[model samples]
Target: MTTVAFVLAGIAALIHVYIFRLESLAWTDPKTRAVFGTTAETAEVTKPLAYNQGFYNLFLAIIAVIGIAVGAFGSASSDDVSTALIHAACGSMVAAALVLATSDSSKLRGAVIQGVAPALAILALLLS
Candidate 1:
């Protein structure tokens, strides 16, 4: 159960890292813009907002990674703390996805891509 939880959460972290790169470093790049279906001009106009949003994704990834590390190696007394961290990080991911879906049904696929692994990790942790 622990391994499953870790693996799923790690995947979620990696996904967010990719999102960070796309949003922060490549938002105006043609290929990145295509991935996001944004015109170059639109990308340029929204660059600052995307850059800021990218940091939010990075911070969530950091929290998830820290939770994984603590769950794997911290003292026994830290179990509750580790679990809480993991839940908070994963919960935020799920919440963000839900918001995206609610904002625009067209974004449902993106929402699922962003949220599924973390949702699974949370479920695995709870069932364990």
Candidate 2:
């Protein structure tokens, strides 16, 4: 169960990293704009905001990855800290998704995309 939790957390972390790339690195690109349902002008105008948001995602991914590494490789003495880090990271991801979903009906799909793996990871961790 702990392994399952870590795997799901890893997937969630990877997804957030990809999101970071899309929002930070490719916000102005046509493909990224289309994925975000933004016009070129809107994308350009929002580039700064997206860049900041992307960093948040990246930070969350980093936290999750670190938690996974600690949990998998660290001494047993560190288990509690690793679990807390994973829980914090995944919980924040889920909360952000819930906010997104509630903020706009159209954003439900995006929220799901952002939330699922983290939610699963949390559940798995609880089971463990």
Among all candidates shown, the one with the greatest lDDT: 2
Clashing pairs in 1: none
The reply for model 1, stretches above 4 Å from the true place, is none
* Clashes in predicted model 1: 0
**Whole-model lDDT per candidate:** 0.90, 0.94
Query: For candidate 2, what is the lDDT?
Result: 0.94
lDDT of 2 by residue, 21-84 (tens): 9999999999898778899999989999999999999999999999999999999998888899
lDDT of 1: 0.90
Error of 1 at 110 (Å): 1.1
Q: What are the runs in model 2 whose C-alpha is more than 4 Å off?
A: none
- TM-scores vs. true structure, each candidate: 0.96, 0.98
